[model samples]
Target: MKKFTFKIFAVAITLLLSTSLSLELLAQSAGYEVLFDGGSLEKWRSKSTPSSPIKGWKVEDGMLFMEGEGGGDIITKDKYGDFELVFEFNLTEKANSGIKYFVDTIYNEKSGEMKVNGPEYQIIDDYNYEGVKEDPNGTTSTGAAYLFYPPKNKQLNPHGEWNKGKIVAKGKKVSHWLNGKKLVSYTRGSKDYLKKKTANKFKDDKNYGELKEGHILITDHGDKVFFRNIKIKKL
Candidate 1:
């Protein structure tokens, strides 16, 4: 009886280990890479100084958060061309931030400013933020393509709550999703895209929205925001 019991327990343990290993392998086979799992910043760097360690962002209680000013922005050290990115964020009152993809540094000759330009997945306190409240359904609202396209059918969670954000970029097409619902979708450099691009703050940036391999960035808009479960899969 003792020998039989021991055999049964060993088999159970082996099966458990096999199941866990199978799940992990499945995740990898699907091409998913975890950018942040609350532990290290090995995959990220400060945007301003790519060679240096990140500032203003910290890992606390399994979340990556911006604590104060002068943190600038942070971007992935590895650039991606076509991928699906997902993350969860929590916002403080009136907080403003964004996740930007296809990000690249550009020298704006017209304004004489060096800027990191990309289409932003706008995140803000939609009900309380003055800018968003003024134009609740406008291009600057949460889930917007940041001055390019306004999200439709958005169901934003209230301030101090968590929200899920997803971005899928493949070829010249990109889509933004909030809470598992698609909010914005557009093709870069399309006729309609060009029309909007020429009329916005990025008009002077002739290369803005052009498809290219670029880094993913988390903006530091001088507000408190938390992000976690950041993952990406190349498609």
Candidate 2:
């Protein structure tokens, strides 16, 4: 009986190891690379000064969180042309933040700050935030493309709860997803997009939203927010 029990335990251990190996292989085959899994910020850098270490952002209790404002923005060191990005975020009450892709540096003459420019996947406290409460369906709301495209059929978890966010950019088409639901999709340089760009604040900038390859940015919107499990798969 003792020998039989030992054999069974050995088999169970073998099965568990096999399962873990299979999952790891599957992720590699699917081209998924982990950018952050609560470990290191080696893959990211400050957007304004790439040479300097990140400021105002902390990694604690297995989470990469913005403690308070002035973190400046953080961006991935490598650039991607077409890819899929997935992350999880938790917002404080009335917090505002975003995940931006196809990011390029632009000199803001008004602020005298070199800012990263791109289309943003809005992350905010949708219920209590005054801006989102005022226009629940507007482009500024959570899951929207930040003044460019508004999400439809949006369902947002309340602040303090984790929400899954996804962005897929394949060719000229990009789509935003939240909590397994697709909220917005648009093609770059499409006629409708051009019309919307002309009507918005980016109209004066000819190269706005026209970049083909750029970094991924996490905005610092002067609020405390938590992020984790950031992964990207190049497509």
Stretches of candidate 1 off by over 4 Å are 1-29, 106-114
TM-score of 2: 0.85
TM-score of each: 0.85, 0.85
What C-alpha lDDT do the candidate models reach, one value each?
A: 0.86, 0.86
- Model 2, 96-145: lDDT tens digits are 88999998876678886776668889998988888887884489988998
TM-score of structure candidate 1: 0.85
Off by over 4 Å in 2: 1-29, 106-113
